[model samples]
Target: MSTTEQLELDPAEVQAFAGRAVADAATWMATTMTMFGDRLGLWRALADSRPVTSPELAARTGTDERYLREWLAAMTAHGYLTHDPGAGTYLLPPAHVPVLATESPAHIGGLHQALYGLTGMLDRVLAVFRTGGGVPINAYPRDWFEGLERFSAGWFDHLLPQVWLPTLPELEAALRRGADVADIGCGRGRALIRLAERYPAGRYTGFDVHPESIAAAEAAARAAGVADRVRFECLDVSGGLPGDYDVITTFDVVHDAADPRGILAAIHAALRPDGRYLCLDINSSHRLEDNRGPVAAYFYGVSVLYCMTTSLAHGGAGLGTCGFPEHTARELCTAAGFGTVRRVEMENPFNILYEITH
Candidate 1:
């Protein structure tokens, strides 16, 4: 409708929706600013470390004070930083350390970086909207993959050791007794490396279609000192896996695969009898109505930005981010000839872990 063509509207509803729209737009732009803070080491400098004046931060970080001043002020306005009018310094609250400053599982910096990198392909993604193709995964900037590594570092470092493994006695025992494990779509190999480091008996393989990721994984494995037992290979499991394995894992990967069902079936065939498949996927509902909320919104956004597009780019089934919900997971696993499909008991809001066997 034209601007001149006014329709009857509820004033309260209009105002509320308008406010939400503006806030969301502001948050979207703030993500880029957050990337700047992360890349420029501003967050680290203020992360429960010390309060600093804009000039002081500029001097410490080798950045211009003019930009730093505006950035500091913006952060303060956004509640990421608190302004001290008396001293003209800004402080990052200790409470915000996990979400902003640190490089832990709780850190939000990775999300910022990932989003920034992914959105950089807006022109290409927009083109795909009209042309019906997608931006290739390799086309994405290094920051996207690095951001993903950082984001996943939290799960592999903290939860995988502490919660994911400990809860599964059989899998844990298998690892302890030298299980041959493959982590498909293993990205940078951090997860496999972490497991190799923790469970020395397990021989781990990291697989990915991306050559750069495979190389990076190899380097990471070497750096982590797990190179002896851990290896990284550039492989597309949608074709077939190399060997039979006691345990197979795909952490936050299936939905992004161009051929998830085929990969799952290959995984099923590749696993030894009585072997377990540990599948970590997005925790989502099959029905759209049940999937309402900001969390689901973010999931869809990332799917469009990276997951779905990459899969589509490869001419595979675009399962997107939340495409494989719990119900869908069960269906896919059952179709892949898995005898058992049980959702692992984990109190995670963002992901669901499954135990599958033939």
Candidate 2:
């Protein structure tokens, strides 16, 4: 379909779309700051741990009671905070605090904070599209990188335990049967290090475009004492994957490419005849305007926006305004000469893992 056709709308549909747009904009603005407020302990103070009044919470936190009360009331209206009509007070339930509070490093607070930094890249989106180039990884502020580390650490933790751990035994079995693995666009080499540490018998290599990420991955491999087993190289898989391996993995990297096709084709070329390619990417299926609900829409929108801008700055292909869907990605992989693509649930809700074999 043409872009104009996709955007064409009837009068009522246009009104509904405009209304949704306004609500969406307002929703993102509010939720983007929800984590910051929570990290500052505002949510916990109003939570049901104690039966304190707004003034009491304000005094304890050394904040203004008037503003705090208003914020709490806003949360209550948004269903994040429950309002007790009989008690005539606002409250955050125990269940809500973990997600909101930054104390549980296992919680999503770290990821949310990282996302806040990425959203700052929106200003560069147009420039990137115009130039057909992308910003270097080092171009981001230092705090943004720190925020990314915070997010990546927790993300890796979840992935290893939930997806990789369960699959490791199977992966180990595959390796025991003699599988060589390549991690394409493997930033920081966390996945390669973990695999090499666990399955020393398997040959492993980490490949990425960013020299800094490769350096970091190399250091991590050395620190983990797996440098002999795993190797890191500063190469752009987007150009063409160089070596053939029995098994290949690209985690959370393909979606960031401006030309995902080029990367996928290269991956296809680099796979051994009967080798498997595991791809983990963001879930774009849950992004329908109606089904997405408020908070999810905010996160997904920002994520899509970030992917668009970051792709531009990096001088690769851009995802444009819309993030690619799993089906579209699967089709692209197939077109690149892979067969039998399938999606499996990953440990993280944000990702879907694909098992594609050549």
Candidate 3:
């Protein structure tokens, strides 16, 4: 027998590991319940309201009383809601209001939805693991894309105009002076649409591999009354960018590419001599030893389930989600023929922004 097999199992260690597994499982279930509550408007109905029976909440949200009661019971048991046993009523604490309300900037309910959506692809991910292949981006259900877009909207809405753009005065000046801008891997084009509205003088174009996303982006541009200034196309940017843009932005896209290097090279070639490139990627450490926290764990899980798999599907280098650290980013930019790479001074929990010049 192997040395590991010959070793005796310690009951205490086994119990501790099992206990952690149980806790993790409970957390997963709680997240699913959170998603359900968010999707059904249960949380919103309970927000800023007095403690009341599930029937009252059901009436407020136009849902079935019986179902709502069961859901409320589950939530109460999980400590997501407080139960008044004497009064037979439930309450969503005021402190939890911001985190659950859809319109609130502190809302993290979309993360639960995203986790649920990602778990739905477990079977496909398992098949890929065994067969040395992967599922394509478009193969996943629409909910995954919707959840991602919803989660990203808060950051883009709150940061782009207020914090991100203002940090770079030169880029802002060029943009104001009617520069041509391109957004690569612009899923649904939220950022592009926002930029178009903020800088009407600058012509904006968005490129995405998924036809549905490009179509949706085009529709959004039209709805926002910037269709004439902003356009979207369905194309793989790793092959080549279509225009010599004065500015190019890639938000959380490089590590997920089939050929990140190729995309970088294409961007370098497509940029004007004095143009700038902005890349927002996951904030991570290059070494595994330095990545020992909840955020890192979450990122690794996402990389395995989505980012790495999608890249592998295209026979591309799977950089995983945490593969592009600051050092690695600088190296890649230099190799791609960028003249300068500067890490923008911005504090965000999830991402790091870099400004590149050629």
Candidate 4:
């Protein structure tokens, strides 16, 4: 067979693969449009699932009717909205409200906004890929942090109080009776603030290396009226965390640590003998091939763009996003002198909660 003929086989497969690739590109465009709708409050306008003409939607959202028409047409085509061409009206399906409009667990608005932040770092990440350096946390924009907070809000609001604490009855009792709590690597102090609100008797201190995050946490604490019981400090805990905490918690912090082992050790040291340490890290497989589906894809993508890069920039082990899986976590905890490391049974796709003790 000629070389050209050998290479030119499987035209059907090539076309099919190209179609899938084109669909993937269209998904990105859809995400951008979704972001636009979110920013414009178009989703909120149609949150009641009301069918409205382009002019009516424009009146409600203060958007250009022509742009709204195009967006409505696109979203309708994408099956997120229903169109009544006979009446020249469009409506957001009621079922889509939670996923499209509100700040629920199902909402993707934060994810969309976060893409803005991540895509902004594409050039820097590309350069890092070539130069063998990594992007630092400070290089990321405010939108990144804000979007992350929004994305994680549901967990702090619902899961912590209802599911996580209730499941840990002993810790729940300790918190109720005014336990000394420390949230290391606390971002914007959401978890601690939520804790303070729920358990007013508890004294909470939050520590982070990011000065801006510390400030934001403090401000958030004040706004939540938990400032009296909650305090935030800007500190690097990789060296060691200083405190005799009855309950120490780290939310999605370990995988991105510059010194994961050192931080784990510090956590063990800082906790009182009877103290309990609650760690929430990524829920992933230790093996590369075992990690399948969209969540895993997102983990690897984020690992490259943000988590791993930032850690490496700080001269860390750079375990990447999926670094600390269950086995690795248990090993590290055992190495850190944590006598007991019990994995909390949480029905979550993205996180694993560990209840550790000395």
How well does candidate 1 match the true structure in TM-score terms? 0.97
- Residue 38's lDDT in candidate 2: 51
Q: Scored by CA lDDT, what does every candidate get?
A: 0.89, 0.69, 0.88, 0.89
Identify the candidate with maximal TM-score: 1
Count clashes in each candidate, considering only residues at least 3 apart in sequence or on different chains: 1, 11, 0, 0
In angstroms, the error of model 3 at 16 is 2.8
Q: Give lDDT tens digits, candidate 4, residues 1-358.
A: 8897778668899899999899988887888888888878899899998889999999989989999899988898778899998998898888999988987878877777777788899999999899976898889988788788878888898888988888898899999999999999898999999999999999999999888889999999999999999999998887787768999999999999889998998888889989999999999989999999879998999999999999989888899889999999999999999999899987889999989998
Ranking by lDDT: 4, 1, 3, 2
TM-score per candidate = 0.97, 0.68, 0.94, 0.96
Instruction: Put down candidate 2 lDDT per residue, 150-253, tens digits, no spaces.
Output: 56665565565455546645544676665688998787787777777666888898887767778888888899998877898888777787668888988777
Q: Which run of 10 residues does model 3 get worst, by summed lDDT?
A: 101-110
Worst lDDT run of 10 residues, candidate 2, spans 286-295
Model 1 residue 167 CA deviation (Å) reads 0.9
Q: Look at candidate 4 and tell me the lDDT of residue 13.
A: 92
lDDT of 1 by residue, 215-246 (tens): 99989888888899999889898888998999
Superior candidate under TM-score, 2 versus 4: 4
Q: Is candidate 1 or candidate 2 better by TM-score?
A: 1
- Against the true structure, candidate 4 reaches a TM-score of 0.96
